[model samples]
Target: MKNKNLSYKFYVIMSLSIAAIPVVFIVLSYAMFFTHLGITSLFNIDNHFSGSVLTTYFYIVFFGILFGLMFIAAKYFKKIIHRINTMEQTVRKIAEDDAFPEKLAVIEESEDELNKLAASINTMIDRLRAKEMELSQMEDLKREYLKQLSHDINTPLNALNLELYLYSQNHNVSKEEVDVLYQKVDYISKLVNSISSEALFDIDNYYIFKEDISVHKSLKQTINKWSYLLNKNNIEYTIDVQKNLIWQANELWLDRLFENIISNIFKHSATNQIVITVGDTLIIKDYGVGFEIDRDHETTGLSVIKNICQKLNIQLDIESTNAGTAYRLSQE
Candidate 1:
């Protein structure tokens, strides 16, 4: 397109110059003819004819040279304009859709702004692709974590529901059996509460607060809360802790944690006697069915244990087997 424009311009200039030759010739001839016709030069016709002829010859030679130069310039300019138009269209297409063709026929101009634009666009595409991949990976990890958490929460929930249904249907069931059923329900509730607390912490970074906590009082209260279950289940348990042990933490959260650990012992351990010793250290030991260390360590119970240990700045040591399970928590 540029080449064509340049050619047209050259043609126009050449045509104007050619047309000027006749005008110049005419002007010089008119001047000479007028001079000859003048009263002072009425007999100078020969001089007028000679001058007119000479001017006409000069115009012919001038037009020939000027036309040649115009033609050459027009040809090259046309090529340049064609290349520019092609590049312009390619760029417009790329702006509309980034995946537009790459092989554009551009002029061989060095280090131009268009070249830099293309490089920048390519770099941007690369970065976007990388970010997309990262987001996909994150989504996959989130899905897997949710699946595991659901499995952990549902298992105990199912067991608790079944036990409650049986107890409700058989009013004549022994008190001993009813107590065991209630203990199972309590255990499930504590587990659910722990999961809920952790979830709230993850999302909101705080738990609902009930203030003025007394650690010793809370422990005793929690024990009394589960006293009926322990007594009817024939599980001998004792609490030996100082009465004034106090701390700054949410009372409800701490109560739930204590309840969960103790209930876990009742549900899973096969021991008839459990002992709670609280002083500088808090220990809950069961002489019933102990934990299968290798198996229990891999359980969700251990995960809950780890989270609680970290939160309370306590150290947890567990020793278990078919013989019994002993869990000891030490202040740190």
Candidate 2:
């Protein structure tokens, strides 16, 4: 495609038009000397007519040529303006990155530079559309994978939970720490149930349009619901949350994220008390046996928590090298 700028081709046309003037005058001058050219001879009018009649003929011939040239220039400029309009619309649509319409032919029917430029742009846009389709197909594959994973994990966990429940009650365990094992099994089962639906695994879309929610309120609600379990486990916990610390999040998802983390803290850590400090960031510190970072069995909860924190742009800081684990969240 040729460059669309007027200077690219229009200058050539204008220069030719200007250069033709001297050549045209020279041709007329020779014609006048040899053929005795006049309005009468040029138009084959009556030679006997002279003075005022001859002057009138000359005026008519001069004005007729002038009007013809003017008309041609006007028509040329009008076509150029129309091409400019078409190119403008095409460029705007491409810049907007709108999907190209079917049968949307951006053809360069004219041999003009502007039309050729538009045709080139349209060709590039076609290439982009192909890549876009490929990306879309890849996204579909990802969704299917997540959906299949969820379904595969869902059905088996229920039966596993029933087996574990029976084992916890019937086995007559000697160790008090057996409660932690049972708790881990039950929480994992619940986590499986919650994520059984493929829609919730849409981490990419979830945080994009997350609504503003009360971090403190959701935490309190989740804590209240889990109070019975905490008491049964005899795990002491502290809450020091700032009033009305709002964050952009899905409230239910945030609650679930906290539930998984807290449940793991109670199950894995030999903590007498866990302290939660909510200010600029929400912090959960457990003063107990520190996590090995790699030996934890609550992989399901950890997976869910990690996905949520990452999607929501929430910073998840874990300190596990010390006597306990500390999880802190901040806005990214």
Candidate 3:
């Protein structure tokens, strides 16, 4: 894993070659003194002859050593240059999205800085991958919320329109029938307002209220508000909620949440007996044409159920079948 820089290696080699010049000159000087002044003087070689021969030998040795050193330096420099070129090409490949080399090429005794750079790059890539995953999850949550909102809002509005159209066609409609239609219209209006406020709360980070309230009272009031619609449709409903079950929640929001679900039953469910129980947990069960397990319900009630669960920090469970649909909301 050790990474070596080719440029640094080449610089060190060049410095060594330059320092060898003084050593080479000292070796030549010693050889000349021994051969001519010390030993060869005893054989009567004159200063002129000795000097001429010494100078000639010195020139020849200097030229041969210079050429040899130059050849060695050139060869080593060429190898360093080639390695640098290879590294440059590898960097370009990484930039173009090709994989980097697993390990940097380095001489056994050399120090390399490339290893540090590669490690840093790999760490950065890991962080980027984690951030990408987080963003993907948030995107998925957004899409699910939007889909639920659309279904919940549209179902009620469609039902209200049909009721209004039918009322308009009957010129001799009874006063009771007119009141029933008006109640249905009011339910639709409340549903639309609730959804709009929910969306605003999500975007602005501001919920409508914070109060210590009775959950039983909220449920009862919501049921009472929709009494006209239920009676008109001939739906048999019973409430078994205790009087003292209380919680910290927004009363208006809680009421709308219940209203949406009950209204949904009246619009889509084709049954008679509906039972709502309230205590530590709130449960709503309807003995109506139950929803199919494999089919998606078009009613906005389920969406409202999900919203309520999220807003209240409650655990909401739904169990539906051909027999009936049951909803349980519990504080956890």
Which candidate leads the pack in TM-score? 2
TM-score of 2: 0.57
Please state the error at residue 204 of candidate 2 in Å. Answer: 6.4
TM-score of 3: 0.45
lDDT of 3 by residue, 1-332 (tens): 22456567667767877887887878877776676676547877556435666887887897789789999878866865675676666566656753444434434454554444544455655565567689678767766775577677767777877767686676767665566566556666666656654554344465657577787777766776677767778887898967566766776677767877787777777878789888788889998877764465444357656766687777878888788888888775
After TM-score superposition, the amount by which residue 328's alpha carbon in candidate 1 deviates from its true location, in angstroms, is 1.9
Candidate 3 global CA lDDT score = 0.69
Name the candidate, 1 or 2, with the larger lDDT value. Answer: 2
RMSD of each: 14.9, 7.4, 12.8
- Error in Å for residue 147 of model 2: 1.8
Clashing pairs in 2: none
| Whole-model lDDT per candidate | 0.64, 0.69, 0.69
User: What's the number of clashes in each of the models?
Assistant: 11, 0, 2
lDDT of 2 by residue, 1-332 (tens): 24345665677767766776666556544654444446658888666543463455445654566567768878978977887776677667766756663323454465655656767777777887888899788878866776787668766766776776677679775444454555555556556545554344554544245788888788876676667678887878779966667788865568678888887877777787888888988989988878666565355257667877886778887888558889988884
- Residue range 1-332, candidate 1, lDDT tens digits: 23233446567766876787677556755765565468346654444345555566656755666677678768866865776676666557656864544555333433444444445555655666577689778766765675577667767777877767786677667665565556556655666655644553343464444455666677776776677778888988777775455555566567766877877877777568878777666677888766666666655267666666566656778887677777777653
Q: Estimate each model's TM-score.
A: 0.42, 0.57, 0.45
Q: What lDDT, from 0 to 1, does candidate 1 have? A: 0.64
